[model samples]
Target: MWELQEVPGRSKILIHTANYSADVQGCIGIGSNLAPGGWWVTQSRKAMQQLRELLPPEFDLTITHYVPEYP
Candidate 1:
């Protein structure tokens, strides 16, 4: 697992996958799309696989918070 460094008051944070957010614990979950109501993410395994192919073994990740405006 890739460990996040320099996060305040946090350690061992990783980028992982799960079918539902309920299955995740204090870690980043990677998914391709949101489920019908946006409660959970879908295609997590596929997304992870794609990330594995695209990302280098070691690289820096930037996390950004984005909220879509829905009319």
Candidate 2:
């Protein structure tokens, strides 16, 4: 498990594998794609394994939130 650092007013935030959004609590979940209706993620274990192999032991991360425009 990887803990996030320098998050304001938050502690113990980790990046881990979770099959669904409901499986996580205030932490980042790793997955390959979003399930139908975007309620949760899929292929979490595979994604996590790929991440483990691709990423270094420690590194900097940046997260950005994007909202889709619907007509």
Which candidate tops lDDT? 2
Estimate every model's Cα lDDT from 0 to 1: 0.84, 0.89
* lDDT (Cα, tens digit) per residue for candidate 1, span 1-71: 46678888988888888777776788888899989976899999899999999988899878888999979
- Give the per-residue lDDT of model 2 (tens digit) for 1-71: 68899988999899999977677899999999889887788998999899999999899999888899999
Best TM-score among the predictions, by candidate number: 2
lDDT for model 2, on a 0 to 1 scale? 0.89
- The parts of candidate 2 lying over 4 Å away from their true place are none
Q: Which ten residues in a row are the worst by lDDT in model 1?
A: 17-26
